[model samples]
Target: MSTFEGHVYLDHHYPPVLWNIVRGGFDSVGLLPDGEKDFAISVSLASMLQNSSASRLEAELSLEQVRLATTPNSVSRLRGVFVFDDIESISRIWDSNKWGGHFIDEYLADVGVWAKKSTRVDAAWIDDIINNQGKLLPGWEAAAVKYWSGRPKSKDAPIWEVLVEGRFCIWSMHSKEAALKEISAIWPNSLGLLTHSMNCFGLGSLDGQCFAGITGNEAGISIDHYLRMIDSKEAEFIEQLARLPAESPKFFAGKPDLEKMCLPDLTGYSGRICAKDDTNLTALLNLLSQLKNETGS
Candidate 1:
């Protein structure tokens, strides 16, 4: 699953009570989507995610709130939205050579460090939490964790090892220079995952009909541009969907329109691509430095 339809943020919490269902979501299923998961996102799609798009879906990007201090009640949270990933991109968390900054150096690699620090954990975890499980779903549907049922594998094995392993896809590890070059690019995977529990039915929206879930990660451009990109009155479909809980119903349902991925006032809106937080930020900072070539797609 190379796609996610929600918004994510690295949040340093003031209090769980302050955040817990501030949006009113059904966490009874225990699919608390926050932390480590967002880091697995790929740098390849970082720019595209930030760009404007014709197609869209709702997604929630997040990570667990880390407690930094007990005396003063200080905590550290991630500070960006990342929803795409590949092997190389996930590896950037540790290897600074590709990502420009050292994530492990800052984070200390304790979150998902199960036996070792590798993208395999992120990749496997994504499939488990997303593809294998699902978003805002009930408790029963959360499967895929059976792969590791046995604490220590009786015997190491590559179950699906023979699936043409050499067909490797090229990936980028979030280079500031390479990312800035593609700032003008547009996107098809438009989404706005929920940040608060406004709707009652699910952690998403009340009716679970909205496709885009906005939790304030990409600022408000994600939904504002989506609705304003087209004349709400002219496009009856978009107009109606906007009324619901930010869900682009029947939205990303169609294939991507590479040519039509534009909105109004290009210069004015693109500048609001949401700045990345410097402290413990996994993705951000696409400056106009000496541009580098994007490799591995």
Candidate 2:
């Protein structure tokens, strides 16, 4: 299968929780979990900070708590959690590698959270942990400060470099068929599978309904047929479904008019476009165009 390598960042809160989930998830599934599994996963702690009420000090304490909680467990199962506060700081830490720096900066921008300071000590500590432990994450570098004054250029490079260097290649697969084959080859007796379409986003009546189907599938349940069942509901619901697309006409148009259309909730995966009653129809058309290009729908 073809593989595309890109850097992934996680919010600080994500690693501790995600590690618990992955560890718990595999143990529950009876998979032969190992240290290598940690390398397969990368968590972006920076993303978690967007909604975090924890101050920097609180965040530091939280990390220590997680480390303390998990230390007794097998270190091999510990996944790496990379935390950064902002893009500019990350750029400085990475010695200005535009590719990795830009990728992270742009990602944070799109997600609406950028670090404001250099979190260097965080990166160093993670690096020390990984080094002392036998490289729990194969290709992943320890989380590093996105910015720090007088930071050595190579002291910490962008996490994406490891991805590009083929550390997580085992987890990379181009297509559903390839992924299935790879997984089956690895776990011949596995009977269930889960997949998520990252493309799904937004909330509104129709959008929320659409996400019901998306999330259901992600959770290893069949949902397309169920969605068809919803189509047969009351005339009111059906009519609303039909009107929902038209309500945000700009999503279909070549250029999206965000000003005219109400934002979708984006919490769920329905992927339905939504707009306000007074939204400008022309703007909706523009947004529709942009969406079509973005999704190639």
lDDT of 2 by residue, 195-228 (tens): 1101011112211111111111223311110111
TM-score of each: 0.20, 0.25
Name the runs in model 1 displaced over 4 angstroms: 1-122, 132-297
Superposed by TM-score, candidate 1 places the C-alpha of residue 58 at a distance from the truth, in angstroms, of: 6.6
lDDT at residue 75 of model 2 (Cα atoms):
15
**How would you encode candidate 1's per-residue C-alpha lDDT over 105-181 as one tens digit per residue?**
32111111111111111223223333212242233123223322212122332121000101111122222122222
* Steric overlap count per candidate: 35, 43
What would the TM-score be for candidate 2 when compared with the true structure?
Answer: 0.25
CA shift at 252, candidate 1, in angstroms?
Answer: 47
